[model samples]
Target: MIEAVSLTKRYGNTVAVDNLSFSVKPGKVTGFLGPNGAGKSTTMRMALGLDNPTSGQIRIDGKIYQDLKYPLRKVGALVDPRWVHPNRSARAHLAWMARSNRIQAKRIDEVLDAVGLTAVAGKRVGGFSLGMSQRLGIASALLGDPEILMFDEPVNGLDPEGILWIRNLMHRLADEGRTVFVSSHLLSEMALTASELVVIGRGKLISQSTTDEFVARASDDAVRVRSPHLQRLRGALTDAGATVHEVDDAIIVSGMDSANIGETAAAHNVVLHELSPQQGSLEQAFMQITGDSVQYHSDLDEAPGQVLASGTN
Candidate 1:
């Protein structure tokens, strides 16, 4: 397990991470989520011992990262995919890392094949495409055969197939009882990939819970009601303290579940053509929850013509 207690980091007068505490358990994929400038990078750096925390501590299975004798064997991370020597062959790069960590030389081939880079193992990293580079980075992370893996923007430069590959790989790792912690800006992918979430904002811990719970808490639960007596049903729902809105031939009802709506419809003797529960999406939840935490705000609501006119005045 990875645990942080009051972990904080400071740069000059600014605080990058502030009293953050969270635990990532094994056997599940945990997603790290936050807006840009939320100190997620700093936290990951501290976990990898790239930067020291100003106060508090982050530990891997109760031990600090620097204190681990063979850190790579316990924690494998791909924080920066471009950290490789451009002129070095993919095989050579893995060999170097393996040597540094006292890993067996033969392990290099295993990782190369695992990442689908065995064919390009002899090619210099400088000539590799972004997707290939990402694959190499993943291969490096898996070189140690570690029990814990950390990836930052792992699908940054990949086609659909590559993205699906990484997602499935993470799932496979977690299924093998390994700890998989991934950080990405892609909420849609994260929704499908991660079962648990570690959400932060402005360097502080906002929430840590199952992905479903986080989404449910952040977004409203609504039920879509379709009936020939739409107006009557709308009145019934509104009288029951539910907010009803119309869209096409259906009425969207909030503040009530399908069960309650069904019972109400039965009591009102209303004929229902369709009644389905609406699910909230991760993107909607993230935007609603992290709106205030965003460091930079864009005024996209302002029309271009309005802005031009106001500027001229």
Candidate 2:
């Protein structure tokens, strides 16, 4: 298991992460999600002891990462794929890492096969494509079969096939009872792959919940109603104690469900044109949770169709 308590980080005048705290347990894939520059990378770095925290603490298996007897043997990480030397072959790199803490060299081939890089083990890393390089990085991390594995954007440069491979690898590791912690900015992609999520924004903790709970918490719980007699529907809904928002000519009622809305309209002798429920999407829930705190570019990215519909409303 991985635990972080009140984890904090600062960069001179700017605070990159503020009192952030969360735990990652084994047996499931936990996704670390945030907008760009929201400090996800900074938090991961602190957890791995690559950067000192301004305050608070992070530990792996009840001990500080640096205090672990064999760092890579207990915790393995792929922070940046570019950390590999371009001139060295994949096998050579793992060989040196093995020698760093007296790990057995024979295990090198085991990891190489685990990540499917055994076929190209003799080739210089400089000639490997981005996806192949990612595999090599993962192979290096698994050399020791560490209990805790952290991946930072493992599928950033992968093709669809490579993406699926990485996805399967994460689950396979978690299935073996290893703690798998991964970070990514792609909500749509992570939504389909992760079982749990920890979301951060503006260097602060926004939410920590299972994927289903997060989606449920983000749901509006409002009912959608459309009618040709829009003005009458609004008046009736207001009189019936339902808060209403006008969507173009349609009325969106929050306090009442479809059945109640239909009955109320019928009692009032008003005709209905259409009454449809708009089921919220994971992307919608994410936008609602983060709101304006999203640090990355593109306002349209969160929910493009909603934006267009908003204008019509």
- Per-candidate TM equals 0.94, 0.82
- Local distance difference test, candidate 2: 0.86
lDDT of each: 0.92, 0.86
| Model 1 alpha-carbon drift over 4 Å, by segment | 303-313
**Tens-place lDDT digits, model 1, residues 169-255:** 999999999999999999999999999999998899999999999998987878888999988888988999999999899988999
Which 10 residues in a row give candidate 2 its minimum summed lDDT? Answer: 304-313
Estimate, for each residue in 126-180, the C-alpha lDDT of model 2 and write its tens digit.
Answer: 9988888888889878888899999999887889888888889899999999999
Top lDDT prediction, candidate number: 1
Model 1's alpha-carbon lDDT is 0.92
